[model samples]
Target: MAHRALVVRGGWDGHRPIEASDLFLPFLERSGYDVRIESSPAVYADAETMAETDLIVQCITMGEITHEEVSGLRDAVAAGTGFTGWHGGIADSFRASADYLQLVGGQFAAHPGRAPEPSGEPRDDANFLDHVIELTDLGRTHPVTQGLDDFAITTEQYWVLHDDLIDVLATTTHPVRPWHPWRRPLTSPAVWTRDWGAGRIVVTTPGHDPEVLDDPNVRTVIERGMLWATRTASAS
Candidate 1:
């Protein structure tokens, strides 16, 4: 039987939720998944549907999720359904729900620009600078990132706030550009995985847009993440 995959997308349109998630559909289909698409987190409230799901790929950014919906989703993942996503979709979703944040293990903090700015806010197109997504020694051996080398991407470099509970797969450093306020460099986890109860979760911070996901390295990471995060047959 094909693995059941659910894609739940919607939220801030600036993240291009539909376009971003659409890019991975062919890969999922070719991988033998019976895919279903939902535009709202409300779908998570259905217990039976959650029970049957083998994997969930979310693409929501800065959205709201009901407590019941989050609870249902949590039950699904804790019971062994795999969950994964990239960029703001997974990392910055459901700002109001601590339960959801605890499940994701990371939150998008900010994407600092090329130089110092008077204030900080989300950047969509202004900050296009080259940065390396460097894989760690363990990442070189992990299933989701093994065989992948550090790659350069000229896009938004994510600065995420996360707990040490996750296994860091890759990292990117934020250097102090001339006149920048911070005196030193800061590094953030660019890719990671979390084991939640009986399930696995994956997150990649580089896919800020389809253009970034178009990078072979980033695309491969996300594709592998989906497969690696999928629930095992014994999970039920």
Candidate 2:
């Protein structure tokens, strides 16, 4: 039987949640998963549905999730369902819930707010700036970044607080224009993975927008990461 994948997306229209979720449908289909896209977080309500899924790809940002729903998904993943997402879709989601943050491993603390554009408008476009990501001490070699070179991306170089629990995959040390308020040059992580019970979880800090996901390298890395994070990797 083909594996089932659920994509839940909504919150923060600027991230183009619906469009972002749509971008991955073909990839998942090509990978032989029956992909379902839903804009509502209520997808979390169906306990049987969660149990049936092989993976959950979420693009939700700063959205609400109910207590029962959150618990249901948590239990499902712990019981062996994979979980993965990119950028603000996962890292910056569920800011109000500590349990969610604990599961995901990072939170949106700040973005010094990007520098201004030529039109004198602040380029708040998170995925338009090309920057380098330096690998963390723990990221020299890992499944998600094992053979990858230092890549340049138009996406936001995510400077995140180190979560001791996660295994760093790749990082960027070069300072880009700050998007957060308190500014000082700081090296930042770009990708990482963690384990939740019998399941695997991977989060990429790239893919801030549709265009970023279009990068061949970025797209390939995330696609592979999703597959690796899911439980059916050996079968795939």
Candidate 3:
């Protein structure tokens, strides 16, 4: 039987929701998933549609989700439906919905940029910075990141505000640059997973655009995550 995958995408255009989600369509199709794409979160409120879904891949950033919509989504995941996403699309989405944040286990706080010049002029390319995603012991052994070594990428490095409930796979550290108001270095989860009830969740803080996701290492991890955080994958 074919696995069911629903892709919920929209919100901020800078994240390239359509393109980013498109990158994985072929893979999902080849994986024997019957894919359905929705432009709005209203689809999440349809318990009937969500129930038939085996997995959900979301990519909305800074959007509002109604109480009814979030409730349906929360219930679906708790009942063993898998979910996975990356960057703002997942971590930065549904700012008004606390229940959504609790279910995902992480929230995007900020993305620190480079140091300022002597003139104190804002750099044109401030948000994107070079950082390495160092894998944890769990990442080295976990199916999501197995056999993967640390890799570097230049992009908007997310300073995520996350809880202890997530199984961290990789991390990135924020440097105490002169530009930012911080006394010491801080580390944030670059990639992580959570087991919610009978279901699983995966999130990556990189993927700001297609180029970032195109990085071989990032692409591999996301593809594996899409499969890893699924009801069928868990049962197997």
lDDT top scorer = 3
lDDT of 2 by residue, 76-161 (tens): 77877889999889988878877788887777665544565668755446335567765665555666666667777666666676
Give TM per candidate: 0.95, 0.87, 0.96
Candidate topping TM-score: 3
Clashes of 3: 0
Judging by TM-score, tell me the better candidate of 2 and 3. 3
Q: Write the per-residue lDDT of candidate 1 for residues 1-236, one digit (tens) a residue.
A: 99999999999897799999999999999999999999999989999999899999999998899999999999999999999999999999999899999998999988877653468655456677789999999899999999999988899899989998999999999998785678899999999999999899999998878988999999999999999889986676
lDDT digits (tens) for residues 1-236 of candidate 3: 89899999999999999999999999999998999999989999999998889899999998899999999998888888999999999999999888999999999999987766679888867789999999999999999999999998999999999899999999999988766789999999999999888789999888999999999999999999999887865543
Worst 10 residues of 3 by lDDT: 227-236
lDDT of 2: 0.78
lDDT measured at residue 11 in model 1 versus the true structure, 0 to 100: 90
Worst 10 residues of 2 by lDDT: 174-183
| Root-mean-square deviation of candidate 2 | 3.2
